[model samples]
Target: MTSITATSAAATASTAGKVASPYNNLNETDFLKLLTTQLANQDPTNPVDNTQMLAQLAQFSTLSAQNQTNTNLTTISDQISKLTGVPIKVG
Candidate 1:
C-alpha cells in the first residue's frame, strides 16, 4: 500500500544521515559540533551518561573566560607601555 511505503520511506529518511557509532575525536574548536553529533547519534534506549559531558562543557567555559582575561591584560599592558615609553613585553 502507498501508506506502508510512505512510512518505510520516512523511517529510512530519518536514519539516512545518522551513524550507529559514537565519535571520539573531540577538540576545543569543534567540540560543540562533536558534542551535538554524539548526542544526536546516541541510542535513545541506552543513552550516554551526562556527567562527563557537563564537566567538559564547564571546562571549556573556564578556558574561554581565561582567554578573555589574558587578552584584556595584554591590552592594558600595551596601553601602559605606550604611556610610560618603557617598551614593556607581556606574554
Candidate 2:
C-alpha cells in the first residue's frame, strides 16, 4: 500500500537524518552511528553481507584518517604562519 511505503520511506529518512554525518566533519562516532542505522534499516530479505560491511568500514576508516590528517596539517600551517609573522629580536 502507498501508506505503508510512505511510512517506511519516512522512517528511513528520519533515521538517516539522525545518523547523518556533518559536512567537512566526519568522526568515528558519526561513522558508527551511520553503520548502525544502516544495519538496522536494511532490508530483511536482502541484508548486507560481511564483505560489503568490511568495504564500508574500510572506506570510513580512510575518510576519518584523511580528516585527521587535514586537521593536523591545518594546525601545523597556522602555527608556522604565526611564527613567521612574529618579528625576531637580536641583542
- Return the top candidate by lDDT: 1
* Tens digit of per-residue lDDT, candidate 2, span 6-74: 889889988986785656476788879988999999999999898989998998888779878888877
Q: Which ten residues in a row have the lowest lDDT in candidate 2?
A: 82-91
Off by over 4 Å in 1: 1-29
Per-residue lDDT of model 1, residues 1-91, tens digit only: 3356888999988997785644344457688887899999999998988998899899988978898999998999999999999877777
TM-scores of all models?
0.62, 0.54
Question: What C-alpha lDDT do the candidate models reach, one value each?
Answer: 0.83, 0.80
For model 2, the superposed segments whose C-alpha errors exceed 4 Å read 1-27, 41-45, 86-91
In model 1, state the lDDT of residue 27.
51
